[model samples]
Target: MPTAVPVAALDPTDPDAGAVAHYGDPAREQRLLDNAAGLVDRSHRGVLAIPGADRLGWLHSLTTQHLSDLAPMTGSELLVLSPHGHVEHHAVLTDDGDATWLDTGDAPGLLTFLERMRFLMRVEPAEVSADWALLSIVGPQTDEALIALGVGPLLPPDLLAVPDAKFATGSVPPRPTAVYSAAALQFGGWARRMPYGADLLVPRPAVPDVVEAAGVPLAGVWAFEAMRVAARRPRAGFETDHKTLPAEVGWTAPAVHLEKGCYRGQETIARVHHLGRPPRKLALLHLDGIATDELPARHTPVMLEGGERPVGFVGTAVRHYELGMIALAVVKQNLTPDSVLRVGLSTAAMDPEH
Candidate 1:
């Protein structure tokens, strides 16, 4: 098989590969978490460009997330799933009015996979991360900072601003420079990028800190794991594969379009959603009494108490400070939330909502 390389060498076949991020130093995990709660630079994530006459219609027929509703300075969660309903990728689309750009995990070869699938469609998929910068503004105070940055005036009102853009411009020490207009879903950080060929300049590191405060929550791989699981979000590699469908990974809500007519795997997706139930369901596993250092690694089978047959496998695990040890798992649909299962020495219950 031809190997694929992005930021790090990856095995697309492995379910846990995307979680093994190779950003900066390992200690930056806290920084990432802080950035989630504050402001920070994270341009390593990949960007995909979708163009072509049928680009909008083509993508609308493929993934979840409403495409027709997308407008400038706004975005939504986009998910691509397998025919059986397993998650292929979880992406966020930021529409700048020209093309729909996808922001997603820096998985190896993902860009190639996207481009290769763009055959006869009007949609064009290409990587533009190298040509632009990406950053995130998270945390409770994100809206406050957005107002100070003056992003409100710069963005269009058809969507939203973070109440207003936050900035403190001037020669003074607290001169604000960073800003992004907000519109929905509890206004947070902004992901900025110039056109692929444009010479957009990113401010110096010191500048972002001076404006947004350098206390960005730098979430490492583990922090991301925790946040994702808490959000009940299905993972790509772990919860799904080429044989998996979106519904199987708890992504049946908005990714697949039943009435949009056929695409590559539309037949299978429709049949499964209409006639058959998904084979596997995404679940949250809350470990009982497992210490942060004692969690099991990936591919750990979850064994039902009375039955020797394994019911599912652990997808992602994290020892959240407030939530304790938790993981996302692919379990038999027969399993109900709060059902108990064992994985080695740790015990977990299915999340009620999963």
Candidate 2:
């Protein structure tokens, strides 16, 4: 998904490298959420397809979601945790009745694990990202914007649990790789958590067609990330470390099914949830001290204002249209919601709303 648009490379090693930072006015791009839709290039995200009769059952047993009775055309989320309960892989999925499609950013490791665990199952996991790309239209106008593009109506929002049409549905299955206009965008998507938004999965070749006809502002990875942070969503690699548990990031509800039979990391999740507390918790921090255009670097140590040691590590930070400057960080679980912290030169405080 190469773009001819202006590039906003934070650095050569930025995860969002080769992405558009903004289309002229970065502020205007951020404002898309106020009342309009903003387009984001998420093509770099991985896409996996598991097609077979046993796909659902196999997934049900291997992961956190109870997929055995998953319904077709519904979107859900799943987690592959380490045997000790550490979060391993997370993906938002949809069943189109023919094959289950996974839209995730937790890559190579996720694919490797799925491949190795398929010993005798009647399922095949293949990386089809080269042929497919994920493009998202976020904000309140997302529905209308996508509809205008002829991508069709998106599936009612569904994410972590059974499909209730509220952006979460943990149980589901898939279908042919055809149209996504009305039936889950034809390519399939687990609706976005940012305000009101939708993900558009399209063929790699048709990206230009869709972008050109988007009829909305084209935002860079920066804007999209800002929105995600405001949404309190945790991305895998960024918000997680090797020791991260599903509950540590407020992910269990949307990514784990507590009543499910069994999976690799079930015990850790159960023990922590029922018996104790996670050592850390995900926190959204408002960095009022930061430059309006700057964000703290990834993994930057965050400190309590007068404390000597680092209390947590901040993930990616971004400037939001309304939220100002913010970032997600993993910190001591007992840290109070109103605790004031510091990120470099920025004075930070936990967001009370999230």
Candidate 3:
């Protein structure tokens, strides 16, 4: 069950508090901003620590991100796929100096997968529930806020994972220095080990101020939707599933490590990329309607004019205060921008990225 934390407890001046009230709960939208601009206590996300001398080598073969050449203080987003190339788990990998830390959305599954794949490698995977907190801070000024926090320009335009501080002396260990996979390449977004998970969650005016100084809007889920649509970023669960492959989702965005040798799903991914074709494409849907607090049910059929066999489903919906409601959907590759699409009572303009 998801635990509820008081937003007022975070910080009275946090813009996140305003967003929470505007959307629903201030605590909920806290991490919507990129970097530390909107710090939400995201301890609920699972963090698994990979230890042992072969830690780097073991995970290198397991994940899509190349980790062998990974530099220190850097992180990469990776996906664990089924042998068929379908996404099984989405993760963020960071080398914290002594051990390669794999941050996955699945706490149990990640640990299980690692254990099952250990083979003869001299590495060990352990669950580190006591150590780190996983927070997804998003916002236009996210980088500025991280920089202000003493991290050097973390976040994609950089992908560096420089440490802001050691949360505790002996509380948690670090990843090994040598990189074992290509996924170790940096893209931006530093995953630091904060001492107490709760400190980063608490909203401090100082944190928001750093991003505000960058002159970017402090956004919540609404603004984030616009940004993702503009960037064509895919969200887990909403935009993908166990059956979804990186190729079908237009994962040209570094979500998959194409050059990384076989892991699970490597064969299917290769076949689809080389011989077969992507079945569907992830696209943005601009529908006409006022945004609502109650999200549309997942997998709700997205229809085209005449209610033809529904083209797709709502991947994610965000109420952009200014732009109204916008969503992402996976539709048949045959669908074109000119196609008139609909979902329930609303008509949508299918905007497929070229």
Candidate 4:
């Protein structure tokens, strides 16, 4: 119900209720994201602080990721599933020495579930989204921008490696400004080598100064959406719903550990992987340039060339700078990659990127 407010200094106008869609020129902002560093405000995401001696172990037993040995300053992704093995929630996790933070889009729902599951455990989960701010520095100039802001030298080489030697040598940086390795935070916030960038999780009050100090142009959700779609990453609420299975969206490889101990949806996941294929598979649809002037709406029916019945529905569509008009969709598994499809009167070519 609560909407995120943009930083006052940015003087951003809302394109949607309680959110800044872009800072005037979306195309230019997207161009900056592709070539140079661009600062993006991600305070709308959910942040939860989980603290206690049993925190890691408890979370490991509940989610899809293997978190028993997750080290401080390292990050990983996990999925919360329904009893029937459908994806209920998705989270990006990171741990500081003191507390493990779970960042998700569905913060309120995740908090409620975590609380109910903590009947007798030593772990304590609290929603701390309001107390912190999340910002991302994306593009080729990410390292230069961080160094300019005095947030260097970034986290060590092996994120999963034991910290005993580093701690013994007194190599760990002090709090606040310590840089986390982009490899560790792979899911959303942190940078990737191919994409080349990093994210900053800072205190809420420091947002204005941090954004200004980074000295980069700002990008809004529109640009972020285009990049994410281009990368073929599936996001909660967009590419997934309560009844969506992890395998259907190609999340099992990253988010779910097949050999890990049993969790809520392990049985169904194992069965699907070993015994059968998902009924549908995620794909990228390239919209025909001359088919229509308007972008298709979310959940618009997708139909095959000769079929009268719809085969699937569109999830998220964006006008990518390089790819033109592209959309992520879940189509029937039997649909061939080259098959042409229709959404309304618009035509699209299926791309099996996932």
Weakest ten-residue segment in model 1 by summed lDDT: 193-202
Candidate 1 lDDT by residue in tens digits, 5-63: 22234445543343334345433443344343433344556667666666666666566
Q: Please name the candidate that would achieve the greatest lDDT relative to the true structure.
A: 2
Per-residue lDDT tens digits of candidate 2, residues 188-293? 3333322247676678887877778767767876677777788778888889889999888878666677656678988887777764477998889988853444
lDDT (Cα, tens digit) per residue for candidate 4, span 286-308: 99868586778777889998899
RMSD of 1: 11.9
* Candidate 2 off by > 4 Å: 1-9, 149-152, 158-196, 290-294
> For model 3, where is the 10-residue window of minimal lDDT?
194-203
Per-residue accuracy of model 3 over 291-354 as CA lDDT, tens digit each: 4344455577888788658777877766543445667788887898999887766777876566
What local distance difference test score does each model get?
A: 0.54, 0.74, 0.56, 0.73
Q: Estimate each model's TM-score.
A: 0.67, 0.85, 0.70, 0.83
List candidate 4 stretches off by more than 4 Å.
1-16, 153-196, 289-291, 352-354
The TM-score measured for candidate 2 stands at 0.85
Clashes of 2: 22
Indicate which candidate wins on TM-score.
2
Task: Arrange candidates, best lDDT first.
Answer: 2, 4, 3, 1
